[model samples]
Target: MLFFSQFQTPFWFSSCFSRTIILFVFVVMCCHDDIEAALVLPNNETIPAIYVFGDSIVDPGNNNNLLTIAKGNFLPYGRDFKGGPTGRFSNGKVPSDLIVEEFGVKDLLPAYLDPKVELQDLLTGVSFASGAAGFDPLSAESANVITMSGQLDLFKECIKKIKAAVGEERTATIVSKAIYIVCTGSNDVSNTYFLLPSRRSHYDINGYSDFVAGYASQFLKDLYGLGARRIGLLGLPPIGCVPSQRTLGGGKNRDCYEAENQLASAYNAKLSGLIDDLKTVFTLPGTKLIFLDIYYPLLSLIQNPGKYGFEVATVGCCGTGLIEASIFCNPTSIPLSCPDASKYVFWDGYHPSEKAYKILTSTIINMHLKEFF
Candidate 1:
């Protein structure tokens, strides 16, 4: 027992663990601060916080307080989130959770709804995003949930909490230094253009496209006004390919709902244009405001699944991909999904699988992080 004391950390990882502990102690003693980084690359530069915006893809737990149908605080949803409930969509960790891991901080980002959080928690930052909103302030409202504008209102309260904890000047530095990740627009495309009969019947395709673009523009300005310096805006992925939509619209017989996907792509293109225009309009200097093209990246994966090691990319990992989301979504109320969850690209009708998330996260870290960081 005495001889094995030094190796008690585990034979395979003892040396690495010791070295990591020492490096952590060394850095903690000297560095000004460290934050939950979003990249896996060896960039030791520390920021103050990460303030997230937009919808479910990146939201930690903002929906905990909302009465939205698009919530994930219940069963099998958190089966993989370790021994406790965390309100994340995935069985375990989402992008925010992995992002915090990349930063070397294993503690989950304090959910804005968690009553146990104190002042320091607010200083480190929190997520105010809802599951169904994006550039559209009315997106969440359409579902009778919280909107992007409503999220900003929550952010105002968060800022006040942060100001009290860290002081206004340091709070400014914290907000300015931290990266802001905005992920949304999928729900809007799914709900508005395709699902909602109201939108389809009233406005022609072009008119609705114009509405999405105009709203997206104002959304960026709102973030800029709130002191977001470094921003990473994500565009919507291939909506026509999502299992639910494919099953609903044409039953996946090559009769894809092209109209919806085109609108999504068009909105994404307009978003890119608006980001380019922001340099002149917002006059942002010394801080980066960038767009991460999640649409194209995800599209390539779906188009060439063999390249990504995916055998079946057309349907979901859940039951039949059509009503599969409803099945696996609330297992206690409904039935559990199938056993071969890994075979499909999507975990449900709308979300990606663990394998897909790993691929996407690695791509962002290895490929596009230099531009944002």
Candidate 2:
């Protein structure tokens, strides 16, 4: 007994200590993939899904299959994406995709038009945005792109599929719990109102802004009818500051078109009031409508590029960003793109780069998304 006790102490301690060290290493290696997944998927995810809408700013790849010039399913566009050229407008991810990553819902939000997208993907989330789409029907028509109404129709179809897959009860929960983000209206201002001259001739800038706000309000009401409870509506960014607009319309100095800036400001104010009215109108106990002010945030990023670690604020990385966009942003035609896209705020004339998007989303999360979580 005495000999056994003395031998047991050393034997047990050495065996247990070695086993613990080996176990620790083994566990860490075993969780290698899980650790990576966790980095993208936060543990504190509160939303069940994130449904996104709007123009190129949020379109994943819906326009990839569309027969429009607003497509981006080619090189240099998705140069930084995993499989490359997934039809996102930026060098990599867009605002909606980054927001989904921020919410820890999914690494990539599938485009509703992507044939590979499965029922499971829909249950999680999807983007119904079409590049070049706008609240104004004419803006969409001009680009030969799907209008906001058409996108809403697609959402209706999506709902039907969700109901078929998970039944009505689960579908309702998903729709209610999901976060809906809208980032349209730039095209309405840039394409329809300012460039076209039709709307501009009829309604003054203020009247035109009010007209757009009315349409925007109707859009939210339509979503509410579809069971969307939590909403994030991004106001217009500085459309005047976009490289394409500045080049085409900015006259000699190439300064941001002042009249266009005034138009955006006027529209934004009306839109803010519209959002406030929407909250009261959408009276579903927990319905939350958040109007994200991207105008100032984006403008500040442009005015103070160094503050945000960006070198170029006016031009994009693809070709002569002063004019290139969509098909014009083709790598074949340009034969070269900026080696480093992170330094540039705009990806190609209009859209923000993935780095710019990440910064914008982080700011939005810090400022407003805290309540949602």
Candidate 3:
């Protein structure tokens, strides 16, 4: 009767409308499943959104407009993506793009920096990751990219807009339920500490790992304070085995840098322990902090390429597959890419190929479906 009251009808006709009201109520009350099916994403049954934060590993095109050498808005970069050269470090879709596809919403996650992004896109999700950003401000500064804190600030600004558009309650729900993925730390170790001598001069490997872990802890805490509950913290891969790192060592004759791999392993362990500590220390009741392990699968692929049906695990598809990346991967200098990118593990020098990224993301998602989805 209350539901029927919404319709304008005379009180004299109330008796005549009694049967109609009963029928209307029966349809609404009994056909709840049908109504919910019509409302798509009802009760956030599907992940309402996916918020990505990281460096080049997950960066879409956020670095394109920034004054950064980490930019990838050029040919041979996005040769396999929908739109060419969308600032993804890889030859095609990055891990974030493929991961979002599993959610069954958007086919690819757009960059937060894209000017065309609308309120609807914000409600779904966006990637604020820059190609070269790291947990350390120094690393981001060196790459001329947005820092981790800067990404959080952008997210906060986005939240305000969302609140204005859809009210505070819905905005909070969207943010709380959205999946938050952070894929940094590689730049901190690979770019900041290893490449630059200043950090090495100050702290050794142990101290450096702790320092990075501290910053990572702060990052997660800040995100939690912003209402994020489901967080996927991607562990550092074996950066020493990347083509660029290997090329820096000695080009073709060089082996995997064991020292750098050891550093990454230590950092991954500390980060895992840090997540455990955060879960215990924080009072977030519904919070789910997940540590995504990418080391073993990637290691297996690298060590035994044939087992994974990959012909080239040591080199990239772009340029000479050595130290080339970003601007260095231009078509003019490098010419055309390999006929089949699936054969190669790395796309350029630092990032993985689209096929490799798919495999890695699939493994991670399968491993942590319960925690995230």
Candidate 4:
């Protein structure tokens, strides 16, 4: 009787039915947009540049100006990179370059140390990541290199220089409007937390894991306070899977260094929990603070090479996994050349190949960004 009465109601009563139809349409649109797409243009808001921070994996050339011998500005390193290597730690370009490229950045985001870069480079983007950094600052300090916090200081210095050049108003706009991408933590485990016998004696693996997560959380909070309205926090990748680490324990008869890889996996899990805690601290609208899981994606490539397109996924083409990283990664050092770089996942012993870097960037953009833009 109620249904019949409603259907038989006057034409003026049809507004509710119209609202229902509108709501149905809105639901359909929302469903289609469920994946969030920061891949799109900055909608109504400002996202003119990207600020890159982390270790050599994402470092552009922060070490170029420094007198450190750990530099990638030489040939063979950038021979395939836009006609010449410009100190990027990767074989070709890294994620930092791929991001600005995919976003259709007009000018190339310059390394903070590039003398050729103008004051306006900061507007497009600027790479301030040091060659050494992790969840802890001690890794870099122990190596006598710049730590993550030290890199942030370098970023601050760049900001100051930019302000002097472009005035406070424009500099403020550039810093506030850009996206902050931070990728760190691997170094801390390999160097400070794991490599240091003193640290191992002090903190067990779980204790070290908690300590790392705590440091990461605090650093992220600092970034938030530094006018980083939009930020993408990348968790640590499978550190044990790196060729160098793999060579450390195993004799190739078995498989991976399961112990280290499991530690890395556990750390990422803890990081996921940390991100959840972080969200409660901030409930602002339109502020993106997402944790991208590169480990899963990169590990997928290693486990299933056919998914991406590769024959060999295990070994690096550069040098024998034995003595290829650290003091051995030299483009000029023909002694380090591998037979087939494309087939292997890692380029050298430590970092991924250009192809692998490409996949990492694509996965982060396509798999993760559908919701955050």
Residue 179's C-alpha lDDT in candidate 3? Answer: 80
Which tens-of-lDDT digit does each residue in 1-373 have in candidate 4?
0000000000000001111211110111123111111233322233467887777777777777776655667754664678587877656776777667656564345678677877668667787776665667676677666676776787788788878888999887777667777777677766566678877797777777788888888877887777666777776766666666677655665256676666666777877788788889877654567777777777787788765666666666555544364346665455657655556566666677766675666656664553354
**Model 3 TM-score relative to the real fold:** 0.86
**How would you encode candidate 1's per-residue C-alpha lDDT over 25-107 as one tens digit per residue?**
11111121111223322234455666666666665566777666766676655555676435555555566555455554345
lDDT of 4 at 311: 65
Evaluate model 2: give its lDDT: 0.72
Supply every candidate's count of residue pairs whose N, Cα or C atoms clash at under 3 angstroms.
Answer: 2, 0, 0, 8
Residue range 1-373, candidate 3, lDDT tens digits? 0000000000000011111212111111112111100112322345678888878877778888887788788888888877688887777777677656655657888899898889988998898887777777888899888899999999999999999999999998888878888888777877788889989999888888898889999999999899888887888887788787787763468678777778888888988899999989775456678787777768777898876667898878887887787888887744656777878977877788877776666566555544532
Total clashing pairs in model 2: 0
RMSD of each: 10.6, 15.0, 13.6, 12.8
Q: Rate the local accuracy (lDDT) of all candidates.
A: 0.59, 0.72, 0.72, 0.62
Candidate 4: count of backbone clashes, pairs at least 3 residues apart or interchain: 8
What is the lDDT for 152 in model 4? 75
Off by over 4 Å in 1: 1-44, 105-107, 252-256, 326-328, 332-336
